[model samples]
Target: MLYKRGKTWWVDFVDASGQRVRRSAGTTDKAAAQELHDQLKAEAWRQSRLKESPARTWDEAALRWLDEKAYKASLKDDMQQLEWLHSFLSGMKLPDQDCRASPCL
Candidate 1:
């Protein structure tokens, strides 16, 4: 379902895991909002029924790494390195290519 919160449209629905998911559609247009809502619902269904996982980005992996390694002695250094790397790899999807082979590096 889609509803407006202020001027932006938001989506609310139940996933295949029976969990309620709600998030902004990130659009002011109702048509765009509905499209995003449908996509989200379809992705959730695929994840549950076909055991498929959504594509993850480098930023997501970096954040998860930071969370898991919060206690590491080199965490500060790691964060600085990640910050620097973010400029070149901010939105690159995970497992797509070798970071070392990236032309940006």
Candidate 2:
């Protein structure tokens, strides 16, 4: 299902794990949001069936990586590298940022 909040479109749907997932479609247009929702549903189904990872933004993945390393002994070294990477990578969407490679294809 699609809804709007402050010019942004959001979707709420049951995932393959029977978990309710709500995510922003990243657009204000209803048609585009619906299309994104449809794609998200399909991706969820595919990930559930094939045990693949879903789509992710670079920031999302990077933050996750940082979180995982929060307790590491070499966290400082990791942070230095992560900072450099963050600076190098612009905000553009990465086509292969997800854990699964080319799952959309």
Candidate 3:
């Protein structure tokens, strides 16, 4: 995801089910963006596995995880984070099952 106003970082990806998802890691640093990218890829993989393995949808699990968190983030940060996620998830394709490459790799 391109930062809407600059001075921010975002990422997008496409999940296994072909849904676009975005996430914001909230840093302009290249290293940080890379880290978030890896995390988001992992998330997509995990979600995809859940779909194939008799588990809940990513949304369901995400909401549950959010509900379990004891602390709340600032609204501004939350929105930014969401943007980043959407950007990272938007253009991704599910990896071939026989391929050795991991999503983050």
Predicted structure with the largest lDDT when compared to the true one:
1
Winning candidate number (TM-score): 1
TM-score for predicted model 1 compared with the true structure: 0.72
Which residue runs does candidate 1 get wrong by more than 4 Å?
67-75, 96-105
Which candidate do you rate higher for TM-score, 2 or 3? 2
Candidate 1 per-residue lDDT over residues 63-89, each given as its tens digit: 999999999999999999999999999
- What TM-score against the true fold does each predicted structure earn? 0.72, 0.60, 0.42
- List residue ranges in candidate 3 displaced over 4 A: 1-5, 50-105
lDDT of 2 at 12: 96
lDDT of 3: 0.62
Expressed as tens digits, the lDDT of each residue in 1-105 for candidate 3 is 434227777777776778887767688786788787777777778768765443344355445555665377665576566567756654454443433554454
Clash-forming residue pairs, model 2: none
lDDT of each residue in 15-57, candidate 2, tens digit only: 8889897988889899999999998888889999998765566
Instruction: State which candidate, 1 or 2, has the greater lDDT.
Output: 1
Compared with the true structure, all predictions reach lDDT values of 0.92, 0.83, 0.62
lDDT, candidate 1, at 99: 73
